[model samples]
Target: MIKVEQLSFSFPQKELYTNISFTLEEGQHCAFIGTSGSGKSTLIDILMDPDRYLFDGRLEMEPGCSIGYVSQFAQPDTSADTTVFEYIGASFIKLQNEIESICSEMETSSDIEPLLDKYQLALDAFDAMGGNDFESNIHKQLNLANLMKRRDLKVSDLSGGEFKLVQVMKEMLNRPDLMIMDEPDVFLDFDNLNALKQLINSHKGILLVVTHNRYLLNHCFNKIIHLENMEIQEYDGRYIEYNFSLLQTKIELQELTLAEKEEIERNENIIDNLRAIATYNSEASRGRALKARVKFQERLEARRIKAPFVDIKQPEIHFGIDHDVQDLTVLKVDQYRAAYDELLLDKVSFEMKSTDKVALIGPNGTGKTTLLRDIANNHPDSITLHADAKVAYLSQLQGEVLKDSNTLLEEFIDAGMSTYDEIRAHLAGYGFEREILNQRIESLSGGEKNLLQLAKVAVSNADLLLLDEPTSHLDTYTQIALDQAIQDYKGAILMISHDFYSVVNGMDYVLIIDDKTVRRMTIKKFKKMIYARHFDKDYLELEQQKKALETKIELALKATDFELAQSLMDELEALIKLL
Candidate 1:
């Protein structure tokens, strides 16, 4: 448990937060929700006592406490030459050492057996912590990240997303009493995100998360803390509540503005009447009226009404048109086998039509990215496309294109051709400021850089687009904007994303990759298949009959009819086997 009492902090040139008071009850899970640059991370740092910024209040912890923090970026010290397994396994090693020390202190007792039991417990803990599945999970996460083949590679060799996944696994293993994570869903696919949600739910300590991922925020956090305009406010419910509260606040402000305008007009009318009477009378009796009018004017001038400027402007995006097709087959892969020491993708063949919006869907390590890259590489030779077909590829890590020397604006300009004003206006749509436009690309956050990347591509004229995890670092509003833009595009889209909502809502067709093979299905049919597998609805009448038999067996057992119960149980088991 922790408490912040009247905590105030300010920067040298700007006020960050003031009079921020909040408490985290034992086992409370809270989320910090606010726009970027709202001091969320800064507040986390203050809570953890890392680097002391300007402040004027006290943060109190309940007696002695330990805290664990997971940053947005991976901070693994590459100079130490550590593998992913070694990094995660160290937590267990420390816990095991502590258990051994405690066991040695309790000498000569029957508790020895129970103490030794801890070793088995530790082993089970390790296994459950993903020890045996460690390498597989790593490979899966990396492959979903489009960097699987580089397992033996050093930490420094990984891209940003790859390294971020490694750090996420490490944090999951730590399992600290007080855990604070900044964007835990950063590089995770759907399967891994589900795993992470389970881990967080099963965690027995405090969880303080700051993430823009709506699903995670809605599923995990019970309370929301919003930071805005140098103040921290608490919302009583989840993300949806917070969103509704924001809308409510806007409406309240509008009402207040109307009230203030009416009040001002009423005061002006009174003042006008008083002034007119005073001017006509020219007598000392009218002095009190004039004084009352002056006082009203002063009160009106002194009144401070709250009014916030909300920008509701939407972006104007123009998607390129699809030209006439020269051939129906847009892409094909025949007898394609690509792997590294082991087969990742084997003999996969697929054909694409002109208007196809194909989604590559699968679990993390099924080599979805490999299949996509293979398609992109084999597109020219294996299949014929429209004569004017142009492809725009957006990789998961846009840092490859954003070099260190290039400014945000400079990178947009270098994307080949765009007018100066056009580039500026487009960047503004993506939340880039004039000051940030001149900032070095290397200095921007992952989310900011990704937005700039989208801005570049959105302005480009291309008939076919290939996007890999385009919604990874985007906020909900930005994600909706992207969804709208994609829907408006007449061009064919080939995308790989882990956001289930985006996939379900936007995709028309899906390609399921499993065990080195690709299975094509319509989105509706795929949903039905998934439901059938999960709930045994594949054969609806058979499932219903099985349920009826199960209920009859339960009733028979309650009636103390041994023969009937036994017979029914046996028949039910047989039916289960047959199904």
Candidate 2:
């Protein structure tokens, strides 16, 4: 078990968590969530190396507790030629290498006794670590993750998502007591995402995962640790349950607060009348009543409800266009072909309407990002655009759009904003504080950088937006905001995304990259394809029903039907458990 008490931390420029406390019991799988740049990853760093930080806290962990960490930005060395099987069995291989080295040394030198002892020790340790069955174990893990076919592939040859899964597999093979994965679900496709879910659910050790993947949050974790507004709210239940309870509490509190405000308004009106009458008639009783009412109003104001955690702040992301495209086809690609080390795209063709919201989806490493980038650049040989169309691109790699060394203020100014105050005011809407304006872009979190990218995209006033994995690093609320923005956008959008819900709910249809060609699929077919691949129809239908019930329950709570709301909530809970 791990326990923290009254933990408070701050940087020179910003305060993070304060007086926050939570405990991670032996078997809890906790999902850590918060706004972008709210220090979720920083908290994990502190946990991994408590002595590196100076903060007010009491953090206690069980003695001899082992930890395995999968960092968000960790990548396999491209220069290394290790295969997946060899990489996962590295420990066994290391022991084997040491034993072989000792035997070779004994043959060459007069250190036979010492070498034999070392070899025996190495053999014992290897056997104890199950190294004798290392190959079989590695193969079993590969099969479980459905990567047996790729077991012999070089780790560096894998896509980012595949490499991330390989990293998870490598860490899990170590069998640590606790595992902490930061944003492990970021670039994963549907099938790999399900594989991650299975890994998380099947792990016997503790897990503290930092992620905003709704699918994983719903399916993997039993606990939630939300860091928002410099406070921590830990829930000892599934994310859906915590979310439902939180929404219910927020609704009830908001209603009560609204009623209180109304009452206070009435009292203020009465107080003003009493004061007016007292001033005109000079009556002592009227003066006393006015004073009494004033005091009552103060008391009421003092008792106003403040639900900081529930009233979470969401970035205001809006994608706008200055004008509509005159032509029906905003973008067109015909017989487009591209290659990198190997053929990625071939004879791919697609066109986007002026108002089309299309998802460009395929498995990882299928040239989705490549295709989007090429279109955004308008490759002269293969792509064409409407005469009136202005394009804005948001790259999955933030660095493609944002300069790392530039400060936020400078970045926005360079993006065409004129003045500091104007830039500050614009960024404020995206939840960036004024103080962070001078912070370098590289210092920002992945979410913050993406938010900055979105903020930049919002001002481009382009009729065509090429968004590659726009929702990957964003928080759930910002993802929702983006979905709404996409829905409401008057411009054309060809979004490359792996987020299932975002694609299904936000896009009109999908342009799938299959067999080196682009094929248009209706939203219905897209959903069916996804459901067939990653989920069952029953589970999908149940999830849809669950969402409807949640909406109804919220409405019942708002209508002040306590009994009905309770019944609906109970039903929702049962449904959530089933899910």
Candidate 3:
């Protein structure tokens, strides 16, 4: 059990949570939620590294309680040229090494066997840890991922999302008492996300995950610790339930406030009447009436109710889409192909109309982002857009587009928005303050930067909008705002996002990138397809072919046989085409 009370935290520039209290007792699986950059991650960090963060609070963990945390911010040695299998099976290796050490010592100290007892103990520990079958477990995990063929692939060769998955897999293998995962939903498609969900549900240990996934929060977490306004509020149950109850309470409070106001008005009227009566009567009566009225006023003041919540300033997002009518087909792709390390998309064909709202979704490292960028760059003959179409793109990589010289305020202005007052007022609706306007672009939180991009999108009169992971940094309400805006948007939008709820309701259709297939279907159909696609097969075969071809090509090159090397390279490419 872990109990936290009256916790207050501050960073170099901002104070986060103050006087916050919550508990993660046995059998209570929970989640952390708040506005983007509202210090949800900071709270998790405080829990993971209690000695690192300075805070004023009472935090007590059960004695000898173990914790296994998985966070996106965690850095593994990715630069090392280690195979996926070797890296994932590292725990087994460490155990084997320990066992070998004990045995060697035992052999050295014979005839009374000083190290014999230690050796037996070590062997028992290894057995308990399932050291004998751990290698097979690693193989099993890889097979589940349809990555058995890539087991020999170097860690450095995998995509960013793939690396994250590998690290998470390693942590899951550890299986400690308490597990904390921060944004595990990012970079994962519906298939991998479901797999992760199953794993979390099956784990008997306590889980404290911080994710923007609405489905996961409502389904997995039994409790929610909400961080807001430098304070914390604990909800006893799921998000949907808590939000509903909170709404009911807010309504009741509003009604009660109105009733109290009416009561105060009636009392004032009575007091006025009494005063009037005394004014026409004698001096003694007048003085008595005044005193009575003062007492009555004091009582009314005592009975008055304070408002339950402060009015939170939220930034408003409104996209002013291009109004000019143009060609029906805004964009089209014919036989598109691009690759980083492996084949991402091949012979992919698609077309989008002027008013179409589409979502592109796929598993991690499946090239959703690459496809979007290829379209945006209008990659030579691969992509075709209507000559007159105006385009606006909000990339998932906000930091890449934004420059160091610009402040949040400047970016808003440079995006062709109106006066600073108009822009700042708009930002204020999304929770930006006056002080936040002057902050450097780099200093802004992920959500804040995302909002800034949305704010820019709001002013642009582009006919087609390309948004990648737009809802990643948005809080629930903010996501709702964006969703509504997208729904009402006149122009078309092609987005790449993992926001399940938004993608389901906001977009007209979905474009699922499953390996080499580019499927255009409704959200419902897309989900069903992904569910069926989750069965991992065909991967091992293609990967083996790729590996063998790569080995031959390398050997040929090493022998200085250019003709043979070229032939092998061609074979490798053909194998990749199959994948």
TM-score of each prediction: 0.69, 0.90, 0.80
lDDT for model 3, please: 0.73
lDDT by residue (481-572, candidate 1, tens digit) is: 67777877766778898765566657788888777877788877865765553324443345446556655754764464556755665666
List of clashing residue pairs for candidate 3: 314-429, 314-430, 315-429, 315-430, 315-431
Compose the digit string of candidate 3's lDDT tens values, residues 1-579. 888999998877788877889888776678887777788877888887789977998889977777877775554576798888888878778778987887666666656365777677777877876778877877766666556777899988776666666676676666666788888776566656665665566556678888777657656778887777787778777765565454434445555666788887887887888778776776886778778877987887797765332223445777775466554999988998978767878988999999899998776677788888877765669789888888888887886556657987788777777788987787777677777788788877677778878877777788889998888767766776787789888888999887666676678898887668688888667555544654234543454465456556546544645567666655665654554
Quote the lDDT for 251 in model 2.
66
What is the Cα-based lDDT of residue 270 in candidate 2? 97
Would you list the C-alpha lDDT of every candidate in the order shown? 0.66, 0.86, 0.73
**TM-score for predicted model 3 compared with the true structure:** 0.80
Give the per-residue lDDT digits (tens) of candidate 2, residues 133-197: 77886777778788889998999998887888888988887777889999999888878888888
Residue 575 in candidate 2 has what lDDT? 81
**lDDT minimum window of 10 residues, candidate 1:** 307-316
